[model samples]
Target: MRKTLPLIIFITLTGTMYALGQSAKAIIPLGGNAWVTGKATITDDGLTNWENPQDAISIYFRVDKAAELTFALRVRVPEGKSKISVTIGKHTFSKQVANTGFDTLSIGKVMLQPGYIKVDLKGISRSGNVYADVTDLIVEGVQSANELTYVRTGSSFHFGRRGPSVHLRYNIPQEIKKDVKWFYNEITVPQKMDVIGSYFMADGFSGGYFGMQVNSDTERRVLFSVWSPFNTDDPKSIPDSLRIKLLTKGDKVHGGEFGDEGSGGQSYLLYPWQAGKTYAFLLEAAPDKLYNSTTYTAWFKETGTDKWLLIASFSRPQTFGYLTDLYSFVENFEPDNGDKIRMAYYTNQWLGDSAGKWHAVTGAKYTGDETARKNYRKDYSGGLKDGRLYLRNGGFFDDLTPLNQKLEYRTSLPPPMIDFNQLPR
Candidate 1:
């Protein structure tokens, strides 16, 4: 018993640490301090054992149920036993690793429970250098897989090597209505995404944006606003005849005198939105009869509801005419402060004109801000998966070279068919 006293103590400590870690939530990279023993040192790039004979890194995670788990990792082990040992509770999986360069490894089918599960990656008993470098760790095949897939998260500050904070957009290919009157789209918000960006926008930022967002953990709101061609912080500075007017703001909508991105305009907020539910937005734009202004009206109807409630209506006296560009984007606004992943689903996009006919928007491409393209080593990723366009940018990486998969011009549908008479005003 005396001879095995040290072994028992080590086991007890490891189990205790892992239990504590499992109780909380964290994203543990190799360089983070979630280890239990073995004196493992992790550089900015990876975890390696240069002096110690025994080394290990331990992390804990929680799951809602007993299901299959996948471990996605970039690893390299050269001239050692050529293997790494992974421990979950009492089960162990010995996986063969590459000898050089990083390779993505998938180790899965590990049974997990509805509570805390500790994973231990330990060095094998061998003669050569025992080392492994990990980059990405993803847990899939869960009860909330749909919600999890939409989590938008990445490194935010890339030491001035950051990607453009832009949107994943789809234009109507060609202008359908010379004088447009209506635009429509259906959107669904994921249940647990901490932040929901302006997922839907008309005419991009130059024109304006209408979106549903979780501004903060507790604040859920629908945001709608348009940009003013004039540059001024004071809303009153613009002449009353030239400034935009909020014709009507729906119940619970509250906003006035907002400014950002070198443009000053108006905004409205509506609250108590439901997650995991579909919501439809119908936008109407027409020139005001009395003034040389254009009125934009937003109508919203939640799924399972009968009547469309008018959200807000604003008229821009200086700007007039149709929706020039339309698209959607996903982003992590507080990437540096929060670990909450967010995702928005955009579908059933449609457009209309004065003729009272609606056309579907069929094609879109993957593109990022010019800043990211200029430093396009590994800061942005935009592409299509399962007919859906996605944009993922910014993440912490020691060597961001592997994030260099930039795909463009991913069209989802055939050319859009536009046939509508210009409805008379």
Candidate 2:
């Protein structure tokens, strides 16, 4: 037999790829009570390990589903390098630090999937000495789904008649696929009701209107409003007066007055809508001639009370010769608090044909609160109820009857809550 030379087999792996070393796929625990073993190399030469080699850090964790991640960090830089790099998965995010003593560093948004996730922190200094410290770290949107929801109260007269319009818009992340739904309660104002003109039926009005929109594409905008006529001279035609109301749950407790009359004008309440969820709405209106000329519109929301608070109002004259005569007076406007508020309006336009020479007036009001101010993005953003264009037995309204007018409304589901327990240690 010929002697075959024994062949020697040798395999070599380097860095984090060695068989005897930790596998790149291995899960590592970090943060709050997690165990890790690697001696940090420290040096004062302002070169070797940079600043204090002891500052380099690493974290590991697993996710149950793919998600959008955000990290909020407060950092302090002493005097070396102005750049810091964060390594996660196969991507690296770098941030530039101002030479200032303290600053906020955001890692922005990152898409992450289920499995082991490792984050490596590396800082580089100018003279070779990098010094920095991370005080807080917050990761959001992992192991959770997005949802949205809304609630409305009140009703609108002339069921099919399109009234005023309210619009809403939001920015959505690309990672989520969501389902949406809308809910509402249409109420009718009772005869001889004690409530103000255009107020809710339960509060005693002749007609009412309410509706909401939900889960709208963050890229697309959503609108809600009551539709009515702009001219009333032809009693055989729809009238042109529109009114709305505003209230808040916190008003009474805060010693704020509630009504449709004042120099502060009308008020409006606001709410923050989550990216994915369902919402419900209620719209109400009444057109009785005896009290119909008094147009009333307001916005209200819960502020830790059972009853809605009046935060904004939209009221104007119903029998004006010109649409330009309509104007809105807003008051008590704030824009910081987050919550969807309610709005109400009244009009005699429903008299349809009985009223003549319709003059449309459109106005907006804000409750003087931090939240309402933040929402509309203006000291006030409404004007006298004005007709964009007059329609005299025209296209969409030619054969339209108060009972046959088209009415549209919308709302959505609630957003998903994040699971803090599943976060990387």
Candidate 3:
């Protein structure tokens, strides 16, 4: 009886262990966390229109601890049959799926360490007209699911893939905070960090923003934009009297109106700006009390060049103010390149008071947008480095700066020497 009792206790313990392992489960919606690098696309309904075998879907999620995770996909084969494979690190699992309706099929398991994991799915072969429509990726055996990070369901998939946007808010000296007329800053993208869809904004005020962007593999641009006083996403809905007017622009700069984010006056100069080279941005805000409006001007130039090219000067209606709320930021604008890391170094930040005296910007605070604040994504980082403030986002790096951390520069640099009289009219 004693020997039989010991065996019964052992059996009970083993059964309990198996039950615990089966209970750890998490469902990651592909609509928010997946990216299709090929012709296929992931929409609100999840992955769809996967007609090509070359289409590769990369889904990202982070686990907090090392565990053997079993994966399953809630998917459907709209036509015949397809053989697909999911690759995680060195381990690969294949399955032949023929479910015509939505169902969760187990894709097998792999051992992974704590960090961001990429699940790469591709069609090995398809007997149907198309591949498969996958809606979700499921994982089991994670001890703690709350600590994991990924794009949660019901969030924005387009922005989820774009990752987080990070910023460095400059601390203006108390006396000149409200009367600052000009903001001067510099940016340099280090080698291999000039990623496509990256916008390295140098001057950001309360009313408008100015920056440089990697539009594509063959195109780069210096862009400036001013939000309209009328609050609407469609520019046409804005009354003509409330619209922003272009006062003037430099040669080869395109000045127009833009929408979708916010209705605003947009201008950009297509310059082949290279990485690892310092560039300078200068912005001016002049208020006209007579007309109750403010005029904003921007200029960009290579640090070593003597010439400063004008981006565009815009007159904003229904506003009267100098530059307020100065800051700098870095963001990934393209959902396709959000998985890649990008960074920008901002230095020599200085602002001019109404009296034309420049004050050194010595302090700043790191902040992120709603995506970072809600913790939907955790790949953003910002801090002081080499006496300069750097902003980094995307690539799913493990180090994320705490939101709203105040920072001060350790090195003092000379204020930029500029002859106001020589600036282009």
Each model's total of backbone clashes = 7, 130, 0
Least lDDT summed over 10 consecutive residues: which range in candidate 1?
9-18
lDDT tens digits by residue: candidate 2, 14-125: 1101121211111111221011123332111111223543455554343445666665445556665567777776788888765545555777767876543456667654
Compose the digit string of candidate 1's lDDT tens values, residues 10-126: 112211111121121122343322333556654434466633546656543445456666565556666654666777766788887755676767666576655445567766554
Compared with the true structure, all predictions reach lDDT values of 0.52, 0.28, 0.87
Alpha-carbon TM-score of each model against the true structure:
0.53, 0.23, 0.90
State residue 218's C-alpha deviation in candidate 3, in Å: 2.1
Highest lDDT against the true fold, candidate: 3
| Candidate 3 lDDT, 186-253, residue by residue in tens | 99999999999999999999998999999999999999999998999999999989999999999999
Error of 1 at 322 (Å): 1.4
Give model 2 RMSD, 1 decimal.
23.5
Candidate 3: stretches off by over 4 Å: 1-24, 51-53, 143-145
| Model 2 lDDT at residue 284 | 22
Candidate 1 colliding pairs = 152-342, 154-394, 155-394, 155-395, 203-325, 354-423, 355-423
Our tally of clashes for model 2 stands at 130
